[model samples]
Target: MAIRPRTAALFAVILVVTLGVVGVIVHNATRSSTSSSGTVTWWLPDWDWDVATTLVRRFESENPSLHVEMVKTTGGTVANKVSVALDAGNTPDLITESIARTKTYIDKGQLADLTSLYDNAMPASDFAPGLTDVLSVDGKTYAVPYRWATNALIYNTDLFAKAGISGPPTTWPEFINDAKKLTTSTVAGTAWPMQGDPSDLTLRFLDFALQGGTTIKNGTPRFTRDSVEQALELIGTSVVEGYASKSSFELDNTGIRDLFLQGRIAMYLGGVFDADRAVGQKFPVGTAIAPGPSGPGVQEGVGWAYIVPKAAKNLDGAKKLASFLGRPENMASLTLTFPARVSAARDAKFRTDVRKAYGEQLSEHSIPAPNDPRWTAMIPFVHDTIQEVALGSKNPQQGAAAIMTEADKNLGPAQ
Candidate 1:
């Protein structure tokens, strides 16, 4: 097993038993304001409302005086919604978005100072370190992490055994060879969305760069020429050698996952979200931490965060809600997501079994995405460049240079 030594020994063998009855929605009119006083409107990015709704019911149940009305907003431009609302002089009480978009919101004064709230509501050290770093600027914390994820090497156990392989590859070279062996005339070696999908490319490339010991600093991508070339070369090999398809460029997020489910690929690079789906589909899937040049490597902390706007009227109530949810016992019962709180994740029972896998993956190699607001904005364009490079429409070296140029052009000086 390629499981990290620190991780393997940390989790104890404990069986998690669920009750027959799970609470659905306990909706009560617990508005943050009285019927005569008006409501505290909140704008949350569209996600699994099941979790949010559960939390909402709990919040309302605890605080009878305050009622919360929520409006689900589209992702990628949550900051824009906040700005427009501010311009209209009717901002939501609480807003949620990715850490990437949080930068723009913080800069434009659309966010409320969460320093005191973080201190009083949640312990500073409790949350994921990488997430804390991203949400903090100039020593002030701005958000609470709600969800997180990272890439895993999900393989077809049946396929690996049939190919005379015992386990998932632990190094880049081994991965390549195994992928080649897994490649069938009809099925691909592996599949992950590599099209003009910004979200897919940004995360996948970030993981690759981290494996190669590269980092982005001051909004500039940093990697030795060889490392950069090697990273792109790997992508090239996947496509040109037929381990992965050139048609990958045409697949969207859903399309790629669909292909993997249909058994068209032996392996896929994705997160626990996909893992959960595979389990539901009864795919007999085996998972491993994503491997790099080294054994059991991964990059970029993938997860969610919670943020309270400065403009929120019920700041105290909001902070209370955030604190309550972050509690380890409460978090475990409510969601399958790994706890952002270190102490919460430290429990042996929670740290082992099915959840242990997710926990260890986060603790080992959870690097933060580039924090520059402009770089965050340019994620889409970078994905486009990757698609071009992989498809041979653009040379890898030239593509790398073009990425730097485009990034610098869009990401103005941090002054």
Candidate 2:
């Protein structure tokens, strides 16, 4: 690569330094906001600026004494930003879109012990059993779920009819067979993101392991080596065996969803967020639970939760706001997400309007991601190794074995 001009280079260096110094300063500011009297700052992953402003306004309206400042952050950078802000004693009152980092924050003592308030403000008895379970560690609840998203088998009805398949596959073998049958030189049956994208790989494996009836243990992710090995092999079979397209590496969430909607692929694995969009576009499609090696009885649960950092300057206010927002009706209207509270999720309107379409597919076989703090830290490493496996640079067995070893070294030996 050609070198940049000296002025440009100096500017770049200064920018980098500025960001780094700011991050360090924010990290050292550890003041949790508790009272409703002062302004409380909140951070959320980037979204429509208008929607964010509305949310902040709603929150402020609910708690008149508390002024709110909501800043948008990126998912990739939110955890690091929070970490830095807390370290510098300048923490926000609350944060969104860092659900995966709750365990890490709790472990670092950067998150508040919300068990008492969580239990009292919104009794565990009130929320969906699974939601409570997903956020609880040992016996303490550290986060509150706000939005839920999960991968489902989205198939093109037109393609399926032509392929002579009656419906979506209920079992992994059948799924593979269907993919093979529907696949043409131009269209494949299903396309899933690869290990290069650890979220994709992890979520897929979580679904596979859930279908296989496995669970994490002592902060260690449990993969039935034999069954999971077969699952990984299946991915290779999809490509090397000629059932799926090698072009999958080029597709992200949008590409995959677009391909499915455009009838380029017969089936795809993706989240429910696409449902509204799909419906809006009037795409003729049907969704079913992801096919498992076993059968339809297996499915997976995926969603995001809310966590209040211990460094928050307004912990009390934040928790109160969280509680109010978590109220069944409020949550149902604000985000239209599957309410973490069972009562809300079970409400007739909620089920018919929100859960019914996606519930059955997720409930039968929903598994939360690994709760270990190490899993979060080591995800990137795992993702890279997965890419190697997908590229035929490493065998799936060897890839997984390497991951296990890295897990032990980085995640502290499974507990």
Model 2, stretches more than 4 Å misplaced?
A: 1-36, 48-62, 119-121, 297-300, 346-357, 411-415
Query: TM-scores for all candidates?
Result: 0.81, 0.81
Candidate 1 vs. true structure, TM-score? 0.81
Worst 10 residues of 1 by lDDT: 15-24
Q: What lDDT, from 0 to 1, does candidate 2 have?
A: 0.67
